[model samples]
Target chain A: MAELDLDSADGRREALRRMVTIRAFDQEAGNRFADGEIPGFVHLYIGEEAVGVGTCASLESDDYIASTHRGHGHCIAKGLDPKYMMAELYGKAEGYCNGKGGSMHIADVDAGMLGANGIVGAGPPLATGAALSIDYQDRDQVAVGFLGDGAVAQGQVHEAINLASTWDLPAIFVVENNHYGEGTPVEKQHNLDNLSDTAQAYDIPGVTVDGMDITAVAEAVAEARERARAGDGPTMVEAQTYRYRGHYEGDEEPYRDDEEVERWRDQDPIESFKDRLIERGELTQEEFDDLRAEIEASIDDAVEYAQETDAPEPSAAYEDMFVEQPPELERFANVARTDGGANGGDHR
Target chain B: MTAQAELEQETETMTVREAIRQGLREELERDEDVYLIGEDVGVFGGVLEVTGGLYEEFGEERVRDTPISEAGFMGAATGAAATGTRPVVELMFSDFMGVSMEQIMNQMAKMHYMFGGKAELPVTVRTTEGGGMGAASQHSGTVHTWIAHFPGLKAVAPGTAASAKGLTKAAIRSNDPVFVFENKMIYEQSGEVPTDEDYTVPIGEAAVEREGEDVTVVATQRLVGESLGVADSLEGDVSVEVIDPRSLYPLDTDTIVESVEKTGRLVVADESPLSYGTHAEIATRVQEEAFFSLDAPIQRVGTPDTHMPFSPPLEQEVLPGDDDVRAAIERIA
Candidate 1:
């Protein structure tokens, strides 16, 4: 590959800003979820920020992505507003799904974020479909599936890989292997040493990279996107990363020792990337401080916006059930009412 | 104009199979975004030959022949639907839905609603259902009732040649995901279809095939034919009204209720198993709406609640037939 101008000051600053925003958003959301202000289960994306930012930065807004339960970082990296995302978490009307879908189902179709699926390994097949849509529509866009190491065991993922390879679909499968599938290490769960070996079965190239290093992830994703655009087929990129926080907001680190978490945090992606940029003369300390300040301000604004947003009306539940009013809903509602009325008569 | 003149103006003759083929051909010609994808759908002309010669005409891209992986292809179809292409996936047989139920139940069915109605999955799954082909228990069975149970899906079963064409066209045009259950038995069955070439019947509506005064016969798919046969046989002694619910999910119970209100008796004929099936649902809805008008108890004629038997005699005994429908109608009348 030709030498890319990714080491520029603007590029480094943009990457840092995105990564910081993701971390801030995840932390804030985690706190809110713990306080009982947010509805539904949430999986924080605190430590895996670099992987999302680096991969998404290589593509355009027209490109597509299917995310996992731990999807806040992917949503931020793909350019979705944090205010609406937070509102969604709060189960307020201002949320992306109008409060119908909470944290696990957050989505903005206009931003090309298909959804943060509740089912494990469900994103791959949906991403494959999105890639097929792009190819069928005759566009040069590609679809990315962001999955975790735990999702590798799902049969749907293998089915998706086979389809993508056979049809030569414009798809990129990114596995953010955090070494643990909620506590069980990958070594104990599967027969293979690396998840990338699974990609070889589908006749696609697989690459492993340093998930903590945003630069390395960016290079891998850029190459995969290029190959997809050229109609070469799908690629699998595994990023070996870690999570600083527990899977959910209140999970105790009983399964793993605190020392392991501390070890991974010491090599934080944002700090490491910052050091590399300064060492290479790509960005100065003053510029980095300004970028950090800007990101903090953005996070503050998003929190304020979410806090002030109005809650959805109870009647809103009936809305968006279908594109048009389905007769089944009316019939079901009528049955409920009739059964209630017959039992109560005139009690009220 | 008189009602007779209007009927003459709207009627033409064709086979149910040709009507379906014409529906696909017309839609493909009308919309560039519409395409077909399934196993052996392109070159092999489909296993049942419902999609014959479409591959040669539309070429490889539009009429695609996929590998024998239902889960993979169905997922791709779901993705295509979300991204803007209106894909019609041929599942070949309704029994094959078991292999790709995740795509149908979890992904495609829930995406639009889960995304806060930001998306529309305008995909149609055309599959052959109902038993008559003697292909044994595995291949021949009516699973339309099973699909109708899902909230996000629209289940459609067309009984006539004209309805087969019109409803197929409407299903393709619908913004919601539609399951078009084409009975294997009705493909070769002939009737009067419109020659105008652009005719279509809207979903969520029922059609009254025969109007009478004594008993209302509610039927779907091939059972519509059996109901009509029984209706004809009982014309002199018992006045029977046959009502075909073309689309089951968004059921036009109002029409069925109206017929029952007039006739004051009801008999539901279905091909699925008796337990918690379409017949049970239709009966419940009708009783809710027109309970006072009923002169006799609401009756359902369907197969026994068991795995479809392979033995011809056992299958015959379990499946609801002309005799069972007639018995229900007679008891109600």
Candidate 2:
């Protein structure tokens, strides 16, 4: 039983829009990366869009979240501008982190979106600490750490959950169990059947939700948020979603069956949500097509903007190491200014 | 108290443990954001009782007791520091730092540099170091060299009661992440501590404990007191100058070089392993800065490259003793 406002026309439209936007954004990123226009490794979130959009639907604008490497959907769902994110993936200067943090390092701290960490199982502790700050300051906010199923086996993840639970910190841990911790299947890796069952060790509530349904995820997260705000401690919500694509863009995906991939595609989050909205009489076929086209045009503009933006100066690397750069950094920067860099030491 | 009266406040004899506890209490009272979190730091008053009365004075919120999970809470402290709060975490033994090295190196130390200076991580990690009580290799370690060798981490090890109080306060106030390596053996050693509420030993400064012109003895942690004792015993025989490099990472090389310049001889005694360790770094820097001023070769007194033995005789044989410092000075002087 989903408690989301699915009956409301505006709510349904917004959810449908978020899922569609993530699809448009990720597909464009995959294409650009394939065409060799984008630099660095790219992890696509095309298939598991519902887990991102739905969990975010229950959060306040000021509430914080930590994301994993495959984080474009989480960023998009958390209201990060696609133009800046896409530019970031393309390593353009106008990106969110000024091209300093490419795909895995993208962050918008002011938006309460703590960067997409390249290190797996790293986000849970950060989110737990953010919740500690919220609880210490007595703020009316909660934090969610979005991690992969693979992170379940990490010692830090267990510590994060135990700390949050013992202190009753305002944190919600949502494990996006996409059936594989990279190439290995969950069955081969874990002795337990359900990843959420690991939560019982911390003495907190745990649940498994249909990650393919946006409403189901939204309802579970909203309820967990309520429990956290009420000072009942943290809860673990395992979203049973699947990634139709490979782990990374060039993974070769020797891990799974083609039939299994096709099976997941049959339950594509975007197409299914779009049909639901049409069934609910919230939008006609023509209206739905118009919305899809608008999203495509917006994505096209992001690609154009990324291409137009200039690359960051090579010396931009030395600028952000510390608040006040130490003497060692200053000496190196001076050397780089007059030395063998591509910018010819003319940073000024 | 007025500035002159505050300066005139009586210096009291105290142990390093009490001095460190006073530092924690004053900082907790000074800022609401500062809290102490670690195992047995609350009702149990810490395993060694260095944080004994703090829990009673500050209550549960400020003086928190954590589970025996180093990586988890260390990572939590990093996150809290990046946000709005300042956290002071404790690792029971310096040897356990291996368990939490990932958080310490990657996140706590590198977050500011990686975020392009947009984030501030004002977190302090206080852990016990050294071996003298037969706590085996697993429990005893002087790992400050590894921490100091790492960039973005400021490290400190106070040799006396006053420096303990001062260094603890400085580590708490610093905007950067600092590691305070407290030697467990010196917890009971007594010295005069300044009674000022705001006194802080600035990081990267060295204290010339006993100034002499014949030989320079660079010491750290428990060896500082022992070196001073050695220098005293050699009073009329041979002149020995003892200098303590309180701050390890932002090392007080100028003070060290200046000492060697005057003495023309150098000897370093630290608790860590001798090879590729703190002593080596200091000795190499001394020679680089004052090679021409040297009268004899630089001498490093440290534990040989071996884990601390549990047996008393074996531990005594392996550990660098006060005699070691005297021998190094005698060889040069």
| Best candidate (score: DockQ) | 1
Q: Across residues B3-25, which tens digit of lDDT does each residue of candidate 1 receive?
A: 12223546767788888988999
Model 1 chain B lowest lDDT segment of ten: B1-10
TM-score of chain B of each: 0.96, 0.97
Model 1 TM-score, 2 decimals: 0.95
Give all candidates' CA lDDT scores. 0.84, 0.87
Clashing pairs in 1: none
B285 in model 1: Cα distance from truth in Å? 1.4
Model 2 off-target regions past 4 Å?
A: A1-8, A90-94, A307-310, A331-348, B1-10
Q: Say which docking band candidate 1 falls in.
A: medium
